[model samples]
Target chain A: MTTIQNRQILLAKRPAGMPTEENFSFVETAVPKLQAGQLLVNTLYLSVDPYMRGRMNDRKTYVPPYALNEMITGGVVGQVEESLAEGFVPGDIVLGNFGWALYNVAAAASVKKVNPDLAPISTALGVLGMPGLTAYYGLLDIGQPKEGETVVVSGAAGAVGMLVGQIAKIKGARAVGIAGSDEKINYLVEELGFDAAVNYKKGDLRQQLKEACPSGVDIYFDNVGGTVSDAVLSLINKGTRIPLCGRISLYNLEQADIGPRIQTQLLINSALMQGFIVSNYAEQAEEGLNQMAQWLKEGKINYTETITEGFDNIPKAFLGLFCGENTGKQLIKIADPAR
Target chain B: MTTIQNRQILLAKRPAGMPTEENFSFVETAVPKLQAGQLLVNTLYLSVDPYMRGRMNDRKTYVPPYALNEMITGGVVGQVEESLAEGFVPGDIVLGNFGWALYNVAAAASVKKVNPDLAPISTALGVLGMPGLTAYYGLLDIGQPKEGETVVVSGAAGAVGMLVGQIAKIKGARAVGIAGSDEKINYLVEELGFDAAVNYKKGDLRQQLKEACPSGVDIYFDNVGGTVSDAVLSLINKGTRIPLCGRISLYNLEQADIGPRIQTQLLINSALMQGFIVSNYAEQAEEGLNQMAQWLKEGKINYTETITEGFDNIPKAFLGLFCGENTGKQLIKIADPAR
Candidate 1:
C-alpha cells in the first residue's frame, strides 16, 4: 500500500445566484494507505452535472446539500490502483459516487466494476451510467410514450434530454426537441434522428412548437423549465404527460421565478406531471442499464459528451450547464488508466 | 301528447372575468311530446358546481365550452313523468346530464336510474353523484392516501373537497382541510372528522399548515388553486401526491395568475401531481360508485348541502361557489319528486 497525493475541488460557499469561480476552491491532499475492504482508485473521468448545483446549495433536496469546504461528490469512472478486498485487480475500471479528486479511497463494494470491452470507460459516467438510467426510467416509466404520439423534450441536447428523445423514438413516438442553440437543434434532428427540433432561443416558441408538433405534444420530457416549459404546455394535447426531470432554467435564480399557475391548464387537459430523480429507480438500475446497453448495441440510440480536460476544470464545466454551454454530458478528464 | 310549459336557462354570453346575472337568460319554453326512447324528466334537483364556471368561458377545456344561446347542461336529479323507452316508467327517479330547466326531455338510455332508498334522492346530485364520484376517483385513484400519511385538502368546504378529507380519514390518513371561513373550518374538523382545519381567510396559511401538518403533507387534493396551492406545496413531504381536481380561484380570472413555479419543488420531492376529471374513469364508474355507496351506508362518510330553493336561484347557487358562500355541495332545489 502507498500514499498518493490527490488534487480535489471543494464547495467554497453556497452560491447566491449563478455561481462564479469564487464559489469553488482547489486543494491538494494525500490519500492514506487503503484500509481493509477498501480499494484505491485513481480518478479518470468526473461528471459535472446540473444537479450538482442543487447539492451546492445548503438546502435539502432529493439529496443532502454538499457541506462547505468538503470535497464535492459525484459520478466518477476510474481505474483501481490498489485493492485489499474481494475480486482483486490492479487495472480494473469501476464506477462510483466518489469525490471530485484525482484519486478516491472507497469500500470495494461501494463501486461497481465496468467492462472495458463494452464501450468507452468514460460512458460509465455518461450515456451508459446515471444519465442513461435517468433517461430510461423517466421517459419509459413515467412518460410512457405510445406509438404515433409526439414527445417534446426541453434541453434536448443535454445529457438526459437527448437520451429521452431517442428513447421516445424507440417507442415509435415522434420526437420533437426544444433546445437553446441552432447547433443543438441540428444535432438533435440530424444526428439523433429527432423528428423535429425547435430553437427556443428564437422568439415565438409557441408558434414554432405548434409548427413542429401539428398534432400537439402528447408527452413533454422537461429538463429545462420556466418560459420554455410554459410555451410547450400551451400546445399540450389532452391527456398530456410531463416527466419533470430537472429545472435547470430556474435552478440558479436568487428569487423564485413566477409563471402561470399550471393547475388549471393541467386540470382542463386532464394531464399528468410528475417530478423524479434517478435514484428513485435504484432498485431497477440493472434493468435500465441492460436495456439502454441493448439499445446502444442495436444502433437505436446515440450519445455525446463535452469533456473538459484537467482536474481543476470541474467547476467551470458544471457552471457551463446553466448557461446552455455544453451539448451533452459535461465531464472532466482527470487521468487515464495505467493498463 | 300534452305540451307542458317549462322555464329554461341559456348562456346569454360568455363571461369576461366574473359572471353576472346578465350572462345567463331565462327563456320560457315547452316540453315537446316524448319521442321513442325518450323520457320526460321533471327537474327535482339541479347541481350547481364550480366546474360549471369553466363552461361559461369560450375556451375549450376537457369538455367543450358552453356555446352562447344554448341551454346550460349539467347533472340533474329528476322524476321521470313519462317514458317511451324500453324501461317504461310513469314515475321514477333518475339522473342525467340535463338542461337547467323545470323539465328535461332526453333519451332514456342516456340517463341512469338512481336508488332513492339507498340514501336521499338529492344525494344523486351531491354526495353520491358527480361530485361524489369526482372526489372518490380523484382522491383514491390519484392521491392514494396511504394510512398514517397526512392529506391536506384545499377548498375543504366544497362539494368534492369535504368528501376528499373524509375519504382520507376513512383510509386511516390524517386529514387537514383549508377553507375560507371559520364555520367551514369547524365543519371540516367537527362534522367530517378532519384531523385539523386551517382557515385560509384568516391568513398565515404557511404557519397554520405547518402546525396542522407537522408530519408534512403526503397528499394534496387541490380544489382551489393559486396561492392556497402554493402554500400547501411548501410543506409537501417526499413522494407527495397531488390530485388537481379543480382550480376555482383561476376559473374567473381575466389575466392568468402567475405564481412560483413548482417544478423544482416537485423534482426535489419526487412527487406526482395529476389533474383529473371524474369521467376519465368512465369504465370504472361502477366500481367507484359502489365503493362510495358502501361508505355512505356504513356512515363512514358524511355530507352536507347548501340548498338554494327555486329554479331562478340556480345561477346564484353556482355564483356562490366562487365567494365560498356555501358549505358541502352547493345545490339548487327546483321541485319535489312527483312520485
Candidate 2:
C-alpha cells in the first residue's frame, strides 16, 4: 500500500512569557489509512489565532491546554483527498478543528463540508467562521451598541476587532478603533470606514482616545485588555456596555496582570462589563453566519486576511500576532488543493 | 414674626480616610420663610447610609459632593409644618431629599407624601424606602438570581444587604451573607433565614467563602467592594451576576484599590458585573415599592434598624456605619411628630 508523508507541528514546550519558534517542533509521519467513517483531508489553509497562545500554557482555561509533544489543533480548511464515509466525497471542501498537519485523517462527523461557491474557502477560517462569529456575538449580544453611541474596539486591526468596528458602523454607531500600526489605523479608518482609528503604539493613547470619542464610549468591544482597556474604561458613559472578548495583551504574560481595579469605574458609571468566548453563543452561529454572508453580499461588510506562504511559516506567523504583525486574519497556506 | 430655630449638620471637612466627628459641624440657623411653591417641614427620621460617604468626598460621583460649610442633604422623613404649595398640607407626613436638620424648607414637588397609617412612618426610611427599592431593583433586575442558584451578598448585615438576602430567599435561591462581625453573621443566618453567613473579619476569608458557597456563587450583590468582593469573585460560577451597589470597605481609602484584575474572571465564566443606582429604575420605583410593601404585609420580609435617639446624635449615627456598629438600616430619630 502506498503511504503519504504528513508534515505536522507539535507543541515541544510550553511558552514562558512571549513564545519563541523553538516551542514548536516539526515532524513527518506516514498518513495512516482511514478507518470506517473517516476521511483523508489535505489541509489547504490553517489559522493562527491569539487565543491559541493560551492553549500553549499548562493552565485550565475555557479550552484545555495543548498537551506537550502533541499536534496543536485549531481551525483548518481542507479538501477531502479520500473518503470512507457517506455524504463526503473526494474533492469536497471542509472545515474542522484539525491538527496542524499538511494531511489529516479525521472522522467525517468531526468535519463539516463547506460550499466553495459561497465565498473564498479561507473565509471559513475567518470572516464567515469562528473569528466572524466571535465579532458578531460579542459585539451585538454583549456590547449591544445602539445608534449614535460611540463604540470603541481595542486590537482593532485584528480579525475579531476589525469586524467589531465595522459591525458597530453597520448598526449606526460611531466606530473608534485602537490598533498598533499606522498602516492598520489607516486601513481601519480609510478601508473599513471606521469613524476614527488610533495607533496605540504611537502618541498619547488616552488623549487620542478622548479626542476620538468626544461623546464618551457607550460600548467597548475589548479584544486587547490591559492598559488600552484601562484608558477606555476611564471615558465610559453611564450605562456603557463592554464585551470582554480576548485579552491578547495578557495571553503571553508569565505573571498576573494587576490593575487600577475596574470595580469602582463600573460602580461610578453604572456600566455593564461581561466576558465571553465565541462558543458562548454557539446556538446562534448559523444565524450569525447567514447575516454576515448577506452583509458581505450587500457590500455592507469587508474583510482582509494576511496569508503566509508555506506550512513551515505557521509558528513565525503566530509569533507575529504578539507584535501586531497582521492587519486581519492571519492564516498559513499549506498547499493549493486544486493544484 | 415667629422665627423657627433650625439645628443642622454640615460637612466640616472632607474625610482623609474613615470619617470622624470632626468631619461634621453642628450649626443652628433661623428657618427661612417658605417660598410660593414650598413647605416648612419638621424632620422626624433621617437616614444615615454608606452611600452618604461618597458624597462627602470632593470627587465627582453619581451624586455631587457635599460642599464644605453647606448643610448636608439626604433622605429624611418629615412632617409638613406649614405649606404654601398645592399638594401639601400642614400636619401631613412626607419624605424628601432635605438637609440633615431639625427643620427644612423644601419645594413641595421635591418631596412625596407618605401615608402615616401604612406600617410605621419609619418604614418609609428603611424597608419601604430607598434601601428597600435598592434591594428590590438591584437584586431582581441586575442580579437576576434564578431559583436554586447560590446568591452571595457582601455587607449582608447592612440595610440594603439584609434586604437583598431576604429577597434572594423569596426568589428560591440559596442566600449567603458576608458580614464583618460574628453577631451580624448570626443575625443573618438565624433571624433572616440566610442559608449561610460568613464573618469576613474572622478566619481565612477565601476558605470560609469556598466552604460557604460549595455550589459556587451564581449571583453576588456586592455592597462592599475590596478584598471581600475579590474573594467572592474567585468562587463565581459560569454566568454569575454581580450587582455593584456600594463599596463601603473602599469608601474610606485614600488611594485607589489595586487588584487581581477581574476582567479575566468575568471573561472565563461569561459572567456579568453591572453597577446601578436605585434611581435608574425610577420609572418602576412604584412597582418595586408596592411589591416590597406586599412582601412585608405577608410577613415574607422583615427589617431591623439601629435608631440612635436625639437630633444631636445624627453625626454619631452616620459615623457608626463605617465600623459596622449598626445592623440593618441605620437611622437617627430626630423627633416624634405626634409628640
Candidate 3:
C-alpha cells in the first residue's frame, strides 16, 4: 500500500469586500490513513459558487462561518482511490462537499457514488448538480413561467442563467439574457437560443430591456442583483414574478448602500421578488437531477464548463467569479485517479 | 318627490406627505337624474384603504389618480334609490366604486347587488369586500402556509392582518401578530385567535418575535413595511414566503431613507418576499369571495372595522389610516339610506 498526501487551499483571513490572494493560502499535508468506514478520495473537479463569500465572513448568518485556517469547502466530484468500507472500490467516481483540495479522506457514507456511464463526473458539480437544480425549481416552482411569458435571466451566459433561459424557451416563453461580455451575449442568443441578450456593461440597460421586451418582463431570474435588478424591476409587467437565486454583484459589498427604491415600483406593477437557496429543495434533488439530465440528453438544455488546470489555481478560479471572467460553471480540476 | 342635491368631498390639492383636512373641501352639487342604463345610489359606506394614498398623488399607477377638485373615489356600499337598467331596482343594496358623496349616479352594470338577508350590506365594504379578499389571497396564494409552520403577520389587529393570522391558524400553522397598541394585541390573541402578538412600539421587537416564533416564521403577511419587515426578515425560515400587501408605515416618507439591508438576509434564508396588488387576482375574486364568505358565516374567520361618521369627515378618515388610528378596516359612513 502507498501512503497518500493532499494539497488544500485554506482561508488565511476573512475578507472585507473582495477576496485577495492573501485571503487563501495553499498548504500541503499528509492525508490521514483510511480508518474503518473511511475512504480516500482523489478530487476530480471542485465547484466555486457565489455563496462561499457569505461563509468567508465571520458574521451571524444562516450557515456557520468558514473558520480561519480551514479548507474552503464546496461541492466536489472525486474518484475513490481506496476504501475500507463494505463496498470495495479502486476507481469509482463520487460527489460530496469536498473542498479546494487535490486528495482527501472522508467517511464512505459522506460521499455519493455517481454513474459515469450516464453522464460526465464533472456534471455532478454543475448542470446535473446544485446550479442546475436551482434553475429548475426557482424558475418552474417559484417563478412559474407560463406560455407566452417573457423570462429575463441575468448572468445569462453563466451556468445557472444559461439553463434558466434555455428552460424558459423550452417551455414556450420568451427568453432574454443579461451578460457582461459581447461573446457571452452571442453565446446566449446565437448559441443558446435566447430571444435577446443585453450587454450590461454597455449603457442604457433600461432602454435596451424596454425595447427587447416591449410587452414588459413577466419573470425575472435574478442571479446578479444591484443595478441590474433595479433596471429589470422597472420594466416588469403587472403580476410579474421574480426568483432571486443569487446576488453576485452585491456579494462583495461591506454593507448595502442606498439605491433606487424598487419597493415603490413593486407596489405599482404588483410584481413579486423572492430569493431562493438551492439547498431548501434537497429532498427533491433526485427529481430535479433526473429531469435535468433527461433534458440535457435530449439537447433541450445546454451547459458549459469554465475549467482551471490545477488545484493551485483554485484561488484565481474563485476570484475570477467576482470579476465575471468564467464563461459558464467555474470549476477547478485535480488529478485523475485512473491515470 | 325629494330632489335634494348631494354634497361631495373633492380633493382641493394633492398631499405632499400626510394628508390634512385642509386638502379636501366639501361642496354641494346637484344630483344628476338617473337616465337609461343608470342607477341612483345613496352611498352608505366608503372604504379607506392604504392604496388610496397613491391615488391621492397625481402620478401614473395601476389605477388612475384622483383628479384635482374631483370627488375622491373608492370601494363603496350603497342602496339603490332608482334604476332604469334590467335586474337592478329601487331599494336594492349594492357595492361599487363610488366617491365620497351622499349620492351617486352611475351605470347599473358598475354595481354588484348584495343580499341583506345573507349579511349586513356594510360588510360589503369591510370583511366581505376588498380588505377580506386582499387578506385571503395574499395569505393563501402568496404566503402559502403549510401545516405546523409558523406564520407571522404585521398589522395583526387590523382588517387584512387579522384575517391573515386567522387563516394561518386555520391551515394548522402557528400565527403570530404585530400590532401598535396593547388593546390591539389583546384583541388579536384573545378575540381573533392569533397564537402570539408583538407590540412593535412597546418592546424589543426582534427579541419578542424570536420568543414568539420559536420555530421561525414560514409566512409573513406584511401590511406595515419598515423596521418590522426588517425584523421579520431576519427570523424567516429557509424558503419562507412574504406577501407584501401594504406599506402603511412608509406612505408618508418623502426622502429615500435607507432601511436595513435585507438582500443578504434574504439570500441566506432563501426567503421569498413578494409585493402583491389584490386586483391582480381579479380572476380568482369570485372564488376568494365565496371562500371568505363561507368562512365568515362559519365564524372560522373574524374582522374588525373602524367606522368614521359622515362624508364630510372623509379626509379625517383618510388621515386616520396613516396614524394607525383605525383598528380593522377604516370606512366613512356617508349616510343612512333608509333615513
Best by lDDT: 2
Error of 2 at A71 (Å): 1.6
**Residue A11 Cα positional deviation in candidate 3, in Å, after optimal superposition:** 2.6
Task: Compute fnat per model.
Answer: 0.92, 0.89, 0.47
**lDDT for model 3:** 0.86
Superposed on all Cα atoms, model 2 deviates from the true structure by an RMSD in Å of 1.4
Per-residue lDDT for B71 in model 3? Answer: 88
Per-residue lDDT over B1-339 for candidate 3, one digit per residue giving the tens place of the 0 to 100 score = 567688998999998888888889899988976789999988888888888887888887778889999988888999989888999878889899988888889898888988887777788877888888888899899888999999999988777888888888889999999999999999999998988998999979999999999999899888887778778887888888888888888787777645654555677777777777888788989898888889889999877788899766788888888887999988878777673
Q: Ranking under DockQ, best-scoring first?
A: 1, 2, 3
Interface RMSD of each: 0.8, 0.8, 2.4
Q: TM-score ranking from best to worst?
A: 1, 2, 3
Model 1, chain B: what is the TM-score? Answer: 0.98
Model 3 per-residue lDDT at A10: 95
Per-prediction DockQ comes to 0.88, 0.86, 0.48
The CAPRI class of candidate 3 is acceptable
Q: Which stretches of candidate 3 lie over 4 Å from their true place?
A: A59-62, A86-88, A117-120, A257-261, A337-339, B1-3, B146-148, B283-302
Can you tell me which runs of candidate 2 are displaced by over 4 Å?
Answer: none
lDDT per residue as tens, model 1, B33-142: 88899999999999888888888887778888998999999999999898899875978899999999999999988999988789999998888888889999999999
Q: Per-residue lDDT for B51 in model 3?
A: 85
Pitting candidate 1 against candidate 2, the one with the higher lDDT is 2
User: Where does candidate 3 chain B have its weakest 10-residue lDDT segment?
Assistant: B256-265
**By lDDT: ranked, best first:** 2, 1, 3
- For model 2, the interface Cα RMSD in angstroms equals 0.8
